[model samples]
Target: MNRLIVTGASSGIGLAIARRFRRDDWSVINISRRPCPEPGVTNIPCDLAQPGAADGLADALSPWLLDRPRLCLVHNASIMQSNRVDTLGSADLRATLELNLVAPNAINRIVIPHLPPGSSILYIGSTLAEKAVPGVAGYVIAKHGLVGMMRATCQDLAGRGIHTCMICPGFTDTEQLRNLIGDNAGTLAAITGLSAFDRLIAPEEIADAVAFAAAAPVLNGALIHANLGQRER
Candidate 1:
């Protein structure tokens, strides 16, 4: 049976991805603090921001890992902090890495070995993974590290038949983005204006790209930007 093991499917893009996979009849296991609202998604209940959280998940995840004909492991959880590079504290950065970087590594160790030949590992990155905007220093740093990690996954696992890649989404329409924009109409407009499409990307669009990447081994090691074209300043 095909399975999807995803992190942070409690909401936003993560939830959309889970739903999409479920629609295709893949069993889903979500590791996050809250349960995915979608029916039939098994929630593992993890707070990824806490260090060492993934370390204990091996036993809990073993049942799903065994004997699956195909698996898609998605590292999708992340936190965005509003702090400039000069003002970003080490503690804050460390916390972000604990969730955004370190946790994925720990989970990879647990799941990668058990993956079947047709399996894939996908990272949900951001435009910030390639370029930076002001005030989200911690997220940018972690995402940049994630890109490097995805590239290394391709190299280290060469000839394993386990493909890997990073999917970078632009200013997507999600609860996270809404919270970032708050009640500022101008900020929302400015963000949309930066998108060549003049609108925020739907979460399902990114999810669709992930679904495609899972099946396309030809895209291994690629950094795919699903963001609608962004107008450069």
Candidate 2:
């Protein structure tokens, strides 16, 4: 069976993507600090931001890779902190960088050696990488750094037949966004409708985009923008 590793599988787009892969009969291993309720997903709980987490996760997954024909690595764990550049604390910036960029890059580096040839590594990036908004200075910086990581990895690993890509999604209806906007339904509605596509993209929509990217052989090093037609550069 095809073996895949997905991070941040406890909720939102990660949960939905895990469910989709399970439904397709893929052997899905989910890594997260929280629990994923989806059946058929083997949960590997780890705090990705901690020291040695990448090496530990790779050790835990190495045995499974022995019998699998394929490997797909998806880095989806991210914590969004709302802080303007002027008001952000040093600790907040450090934590954001650890989780959003450094940890993912570490995990991918450790996992790559164990992957089969032709394996794919997918990074869940953000539209903010190109277009910055207010109150998320740390998040925007981390995501932009993540895009650079993806591109460099693609160039470094393409010769070995390992594909790397970035899938940048716009603001979507997820728990993360809900927490960011709070109970301001009017503001949320207005922002949702401000997209040129006339709607906020769903988590499942992004999950489908992930699946498509995984299946496309021509997509090595592709940086796709899935933003409901908004904030395209």
Candidate 3:
């Protein structure tokens, strides 16, 4: 069976990605702080916010990767608290960079060698990755760096038939958003109405895009913008 490893698989887009692969009978391994969403999928508990978490993820996944003909690794776990550029702290920036960009970089190094030909590496980015939004300096910077990482990975590994792509999703109606905005009607309306239909991006929609990227042979080194014209450049 084809093996799939997805980080932050306990919730949101990551959960959706894992579920999509599992639905197709792929062997799904999830790494997250929370418990597994389903019984069949294997869950590796991790706190990506902690230092060395990236190295730990790579080490923990080594055993499951043996002799696999096909493999997919999705980096989706990320954390960010509201902080403007003017108010951002050095520690907060370091933590954000570590989890959102640095850790992914390290984990990629450890895992890429074990992947055979035809493997896929997907990085989950944000609309903020290309565009700057006030009050989220850390997240914006980290995601932008993630895009660079994805592009470089593609160039570095494409010759070996490994495909790397970055998928950037717009404002999504996930529980994380709920936690961030709470019951604020104005913020909710503004975010959800970013699209032409005035609806928030769904986790399943992002999952669909990921699925497409995984299978599209011509997509190596591609950077896809999945936002519904939100903050379109």
Candidate 4:
């Protein structure tokens, strides 16, 4: 049976990805702080921001890891904090890495070995994964590290038949984006204006990109930007 093991499917792009996979009849397992609202998705409650959280999930995940003909593991959970490089504290940075970086590594150790041929490991990155934006120093740092992780995974898993890549989404329309732009038309406009499309990308679009990446082994080690073209300043 084909399966999709994804992190942070409770909402936003993560939720969309889970639903997309489910539509294709793949068994979906979500690991996140809250359950995915979608029917037929199996949720494993986890607070990924807490250090060592994924380590304790081995037993809970063992059943799903067994004998699957195809598997797709997506590292999608992430945190973005508003802080400048000068103002970013080590503790604050560590907290971000715990979720955005370390948790994925921990889960990879547990899941990668069990993956059968025709499996894929995908990382949900941001435009910030490659470029720096002000007031989100921690997020930028963690995302850049995620790119490196994806590249390393491709190299280390060579000849294993498991492809890996990072998909970077630009200015996506999600609940989180709406909350950040609350009651501010200018903020929304400014964000949309950055995109050549002059609109935020639908979560489903990014989900579609991920679904494609899962089946395209030729894209291994590629850093794909699913964000509609962004106009440079």
What is the per-residue lDDT of model 1 for residues 122-187, given as tens digits with 9 covering 90 to 100? 999999999998899899999999999999999999998999999999999999999988999999
lDDT of each: 0.94, 0.83, 0.85, 0.95
Ranked candidates (TM-score, high to low): 1, 4, 3, 2
Can you list the residue pairs that collide in candidate 4?
none
Better of 1 and 2 by lDDT: 1
* Candidate 2, residue 173: how far the Cα is off, in Å: 1.0
The digit string of per-residue lDDT tens for model 2 on 1-233 reads: 88778999999989988988787788898888998899888988898777567666667777777764778889899888779999999888888888888788777767877777767889999888776888889999999899898888888886777787889988788898888889998978777776887678898899888887777658887789888776332
| Candidate 1 Cα errors over 4 Å, as ranges | none
Candidate 3's residue-wise lDDT over 1-233, tens digit each? Answer: 88888888888898889888888888988888896586589988987778887776766888878886688889999875789998999999999998898778777887899888888999999888888878889999999999899989988886787898889888887778788888899998877777766888899999989988887758887788898876332
| Model 4, position 103: C-alpha lDDT score | 97
What is the overall TM-score of model 2 with all chains considered together? 0.94
TM-score of each: 0.99, 0.94, 0.95, 0.98
Ranking by lDDT: 4, 1, 3, 2
lDDT of 3: 0.85
